[model samples]
Target: MLIPSAQTGLQKALLAIIAAGGVAPAEGADDSYIIEEIRAVGPGCPPGTFDFDAEGQHFVYDEMILWHPDPAGRTVQYTNCLTTIAIDVAEGIQVSVAHARARGHATLDPGIVARHTMKFFFAGDPSGAMSHTELTGPFDDDYDLSGQLSPGGEAWSTCGEPVVLGIDSSLQLNASHNPAGTAELSVDRLDMKIQARRC
Candidate 1:
């Protein structure tokens, strides 16, 4: 059945169906939408900050995005993301992207790309509590993220945190604090150890 769509091409149509992940259609079948049209309605900005004294101190993020014909069969992507030092403020951020895994003779070097899609979770509080934040979609999914942000994803208050995250395999996160919003974060496994100063 070829339903008329305002968009072009057939791949996009099929992509929409398969992209549903596990979200089955409702009882009514008339509900119409687009694949890329599916947007994540969540927090616009990530809240809180990275406390070196508490949650470790430094952290790093990496991932890859590419076309995979088989979702269950293959996840062969060459993606990696990293951000500059950050703290518990609201300063600007800079991120870098590199290739982690690639197939064929092709390779994606750590260069300047654009926005990219991803899933992440963040939790903490410049105050005393904690908070949680999450992003569903509209992923820019770019490459080299010099000025890009890795989905900051969490903004809890005093007792919030990212729980039961349902996103891609990788996530990137960065944060700033204080009036100046300056800090440094490095990663060891999934633990970020921040070494920054807040005044």
Candidate 2:
């Protein structure tokens, strides 16, 4: 992992503990870098409701809920969150989003349906240079889903260039013919494995 320039030994230890079982493995490697910034937007992840930790390697969304009451009487409801992370790394390095996991809870009427979609990509990369996933159901309980980037599916950053990673996720609920029904979805945690290499 890339250590920040201003980080102290204690800070590095704390970050290591927090990032356990999370971030990608590349510790003690060259091309040291730091997460310059993380920007998030959308109704589900408004200001102060979502944040990045572990050196901007992990994301937490507190109150990322999409609720629709009386689906039959109302239009379909959806909520989305878009995040971008800027990484300041030494030149001659490349970065990639290797894996991702999403944990959430959903409550839907028997007839109602919901969809969870996520996409990971590097800024300025071709549209095809991205990882996407979609899962739908009449889910009624907690759920955990994960995705891994295959060898050929990896989206690498441009060698010797700045890296900006974008992650887009959404929860959409569709109404059924039921006269009175409610649908709700809450995304609690989202983890990503961001790896860097010497290119």
Candidate 3:
């Protein structure tokens, strides 16, 4: 129930953008993307408890990227890149990652890791009065698969630290408007640049 009580200006702006069919890539451009930026007032779950204020705090989803290309020309990707949840507080914030399985997916055992499992949901009141969305996942941030077999049985490996395999995170947003609206989001920014060539 960590949803926003009211629709912030940022939400409205984002709704407008989506309603307008979202941004499109430039004609014949090598790459294209969209950014959703907004500020809103909401409660923050900082470690233990949730807090709110009369003067809404600032929240930004600057990581909302609609689409981008893999520099290696492997494939076209569409993703909601990243997000930043900010609340007005006097001290620094400490956030921790939970080790669990994503919804609608198999549970994570002790030794096995989840490479990339995510679950997102958006719901609204039947009367279209309020709406909210949530995103959760358990991705393995330390699962390495270098020198792994490709789908086509070829040698294809990535050179890097163990990226997300199975990880877990939770975020919820509820608005007192447009209960029928739907939204999708990602937890944080992911660096997808190719560091080495087929390492």
Local distance difference test, each candidate: 0.21, 0.63, 0.22
Per-residue lDDT of candidate 1, residues 1-199 (tens digit): 1111121222233334234442222221111211111111112111221111222222223212233222433322233332111112222321111111111111122221112323222212111111122222222322221111122222221112111111122222222112122211111123321111111
What C-alpha lDDT, on a 0 to 100 scale, does residue 5 get in candidate 3?
A: 28
Q: lDDT score, residue 119, model 3?
A: 19
Q: After superposition, how far is residue 149 of candidate 2 from its true place, in Å?
A: 5.9
Ranking by lDDT: 2, 3, 1
Off by over 4 Å in 3: 1-4, 23-199
Model 1 ranges off by over 4 Å: 1-65, 71-122, 125-142, 147-195
Give me the candidate number with maximum lDDT: 2
The 10-residue segment of model 2 with minimum total lDDT is 1-10
Sort the predicted structures by TM-score, highest score first: 2, 1, 3
RMSD (Cα, Å) for all candidates, in order, is: 20.6, 10.6, 20.8
- Following a full C-alpha superposition, what root-mean-square deviation does model 3 have from the true structure? 20.8
Across 52-128, the per-residue lDDT of candidate 3 in tens digits comes to 12221212233322111224332222332111221111122211111112221222222222222221111110111
Provide TM-scores for the models: 0.19, 0.75, 0.16
- Who is ahead in lDDT, 2 or 3? 2
Worst 10 residues of 3 by lDDT: 120-129
